[model samples]
Target chain A: MIHRLIYPCEQAAKLSSRAMEQALTMPERVRLRLHLMMCERCTNFSRQIEFLRRASRKIPEVLENDAD
Target chain B: MAKYLGARFARCHETGITTRSISTMAEDDDLAQSLETHRKYLQRYAQFHLRDPSLAEDAVQDTLVAALSQRDRFQGRSQLRTWLTGILKHKVIDLMRSRDRALPPDAFSLDQDNNSAEGAFDAGGNWVDPPADWGKPDAALEASQFWRVYQECCQRMSRRDALVYSMREVMGLSSEEICKKIEITTTNLHVILFRARQSLRTCISKNWFGTQHD
Candidate 1:
């Protein structure tokens, strides 16, 4: 059996939610940051947060201009 | 006596010159300049976070109006930006509440427990093992490109999915609260989140990575 070095992806996804909210405690934040540093998957997960935020911010202009 | 003198010298060395200048015209001028700077930043920040150009504009306007009307109440405890953001946060919440009535309850999931650890790995991380040559990609793409594609992709998602994605990923709402807001069961929430993530991944890969690879 392969020993997993990190938490499962679903847990990581859940963590991504907490990470975006800036809700993770300092120690948890540090651990997540460390995990992200070593893990491309987590790094991409973090980028997803940034991507979503950027996308959400753009909605106002689209909604305002009545543009598709 | 020499050691005592040496310790005294060290203590004196550690305590550098300390001068407390009385507040002056220059200090007041600097404060005024800082306040104006903060007001500008707060407006831009409000616009970014709220995502309704008009609501963002209104929130900032209200912030400025309130700040000006209550200028005398400005204490030095917090920076002006912090205070303005606090006010703007309340305004954003008010706006969301009003908008929430017309919108369906958010339906994103937060179910990490049911997956037999192995199944979760494929969706979460194990699917794409990084190459030894892999490094940070060039960040040279115009900021607008990423956001534009991202917005288009988000629009393609279901309303509930979009709302959950925005609330969880953008606004950072907790799963429990998002479930309550979106009016979905926990199981449904997980299903929504999973599907939303999958859709976003497909959209991003096709729009972003596929082009680069081609």
Candidate 2:
């Protein structure tokens, strides 16, 4: 029963990244949560992609200031 | 030349020029030159979102033309590049919309998720090389060097992937909006985004975060 609830790291990573753009379904959310609870690397992967999104928004300003 | 200056002066008075410097012509020349300086950077930026080189060039051209025509409105409150980018952003979006409408249904040729995992996973869908710890992410934001590295990683993506990624993340466009503009389904959009994020994560980890498993 517990095994069925667990998503592999690849699926967990995809769900975590997808969660940023759209709301995951209840089952997806639940399974991803369960997977994340046990998976340290996937949790870190989720956090890094979130960080990437936030960082990306500032790119225009960064490029502007880079001009001579 | 004197007749032209006289006409310009009369027009300036008629339009109620509030902040006219002594040499309006020279200032106009300077503004043109300055706008030209940022053209390459603007092209790079537009290409990152537009995917087609000609479309990107046309968008930048339209932006400069609009900027010059509305030179009076530039209050100099922001940097010149920032101001030009503000204009270019709109021009790029307008081009994207119009071009999407003009293209045939078969024009897009959106690739499937071909290189998504790129051997990151094994047959059982398990991680071949799992993600490593990235300490203190917020601190990296303060380092300009880190941003340069980030820019490099972004440039390393395929053109279509970069376009979709920039649309979603940088331009703050919604998934629905991107799907409509690019003529792609939400599922395909997710695949492109997933690939982009995965590649960027690996690049940043290898370059900036130092993949030392602690």
Candidate 3:
């Protein structure tokens, strides 16, 4: 299999979410960064994932003491 | 199958029941009151995960009844809300597991087709049109009505995609745990999650950010 520096937006998006599941290999890491460096869309997509994760963590916390 | 089959619920409201022991009625009252107070949160949490409002309402109702029935086991928990969420997670998963895999004929097709996020770049993997900066998006998240729209967006997505998003984002389940719990592999989890986020971001960008300041 041939490895490249940059991945397509689709692959980059998948890798971004995969990174949340487990650690990425060195090549996968490099390709993701290289792709993001050239693709503003994936960079924004990565940030959106980060934001969603953070926001979602607080959903259950919001009404924790409301009932008592 | 109605839980309210007890005469306690059927008793005339104008004149309270004078039949059985008062202690049983008191305990039932306390449990019912607690569950009722937390109903909205339970319903919202279920809706977020299940993506079907009617199914969500049923799950919430079931969860409330289950919690009340098992109140002896849950007596004096530090955070009742968290406990309720735990019950809700199981209900959502059980409902999903029991149903036929609702994968739409072509909506949830494999990532190889990659129809959603494709065509945004050239052959060399450069962005054809860059995404706009959504600076300090927390302001929108903190909005009073943001979650309503958020759930709306999740509901708009395909069932499987929304479930993955809900399990990961709303229920805070790890992707590995989700893969082990369900039939989906880790690779499919990635693609589904990517699609979910893409769809949510686009929806929010159009609906929330477009109409708000900053």
Candidate 4:
């Protein structure tokens, strides 16, 4: 039933980024979960976003000691 | 001021600490050398965030001068670049705050075009075009080529968008702080961030990861 109530991918993507910055409402969270369950592409997109966020945090660390 | 720099150099000698009896003049030379070495990186770092070459140059030049005069305060534990960046961060914030005053009343034109995450879904809120698997992405982060392509993508974005993105992602500033620095509303910053991420994703996928990034 949850999967059947699929939220749109655009909404899912928006919620996905918002989730990084702050808490998502329960309904928002549930709908996004349902959408992700039904969509591999959204899941992939979400993971890619998380990866970028994490990588960004590491940039200074990478550049700090560079002899250049 | 030149007078202040002169005072700092004079004080360098007054320390009279036996351990550092080595000429303060020598330490001064080292600071000058290191500051010059890091100039390009510092300039690029500022330019990358400010998206204005002249302002970036101004911030970097000030940062170098400040670092030079305050050389005595630098503890040896951290890398010099890291220390310089710490100082540069403050300088950039100061420059941006002042620069905001000169901005036109309509500086941050809300780019409504990107507000809609277009083609991301259908009217019913379901995926019309879904994202593709990026495979294992960890390996790509270590690839120098990936960084080159990522920098190109950033450089290609509009000035304001690039500034907002760099402030958030590269500088790791909080969204609220970024809003205050750039003087934009939170919603506008989010839209800009989303657009930046979308463009970066497209660029990365097409150039580095796979095709169809566009």
The candidate that wins on lDDT is: 2
Interface RMSD of each: 7.6, 1.9, 3.2, 2.2
Please provide TM-scores, in order, for all candidate models, with all chains considered together: 0.45, 0.72, 0.76, 0.75
The true-versus-predicted C-alpha distance at residue B68 of model 1, in Å, is: 3.9
The DockQ assigned to candidate 3 is 0.45
How do the residues B35-148 of candidate 3 rate in per-residue lDDT, one tens digit apiece? 777788787667656657898988987787787657778867657777787888988888976663564556556755554544555565555555567788887656657766
The local distance difference test score of each candidate is: 0.55, 0.80, 0.72, 0.74
RMSD values, in order shown: 16.1, 6.1, 5.3, 4.9
Q: Which digits, one per residue and each the tens of the lDDT, describe model 4 over residues A2-50?
A: 4457755776787788787668889888888887887788888889888
Q: Summing lDDT over every window of 10 consecutive residues in candidate 2 chain A, give the lowest-scoring window.
A: A59-68
Candidate that beats the other on lDDT, 2 or 4, i.e. the better one? 2
- DockQ-wise, the better of 2 and 3 is 2
Best-first order by DockQ: 2, 4, 3, 1
Quote the lDDT for B14 in model 3. 32
TM-score of B-chain for each predicted structure, in order = 0.48, 0.61, 0.74, 0.71
Top model by DockQ, which number?
2
Worst 10 residues of 1 chain B by lDDT: B129-138
Residue B143 of model 1 has an lDDT of 45
Give the alpha carbon lDDT tens digit for every residue of B1-214 in model 2. 2234345546766786657665886787677778878888898888757868998988988888788778888989898887888788778877876866676756556556444457777767788878888877888887888986887898787656776888888877799988997678988888888888999999999988983322
The C-alpha stretches of model 3 lying farther than 4 A from their native spots are: A1-3, A34-39, A60-68, B1-29, B51-53, B97-111, B115-124, B210-214
Candidate 4 C-alpha error for residue B188, in Å: 2.7
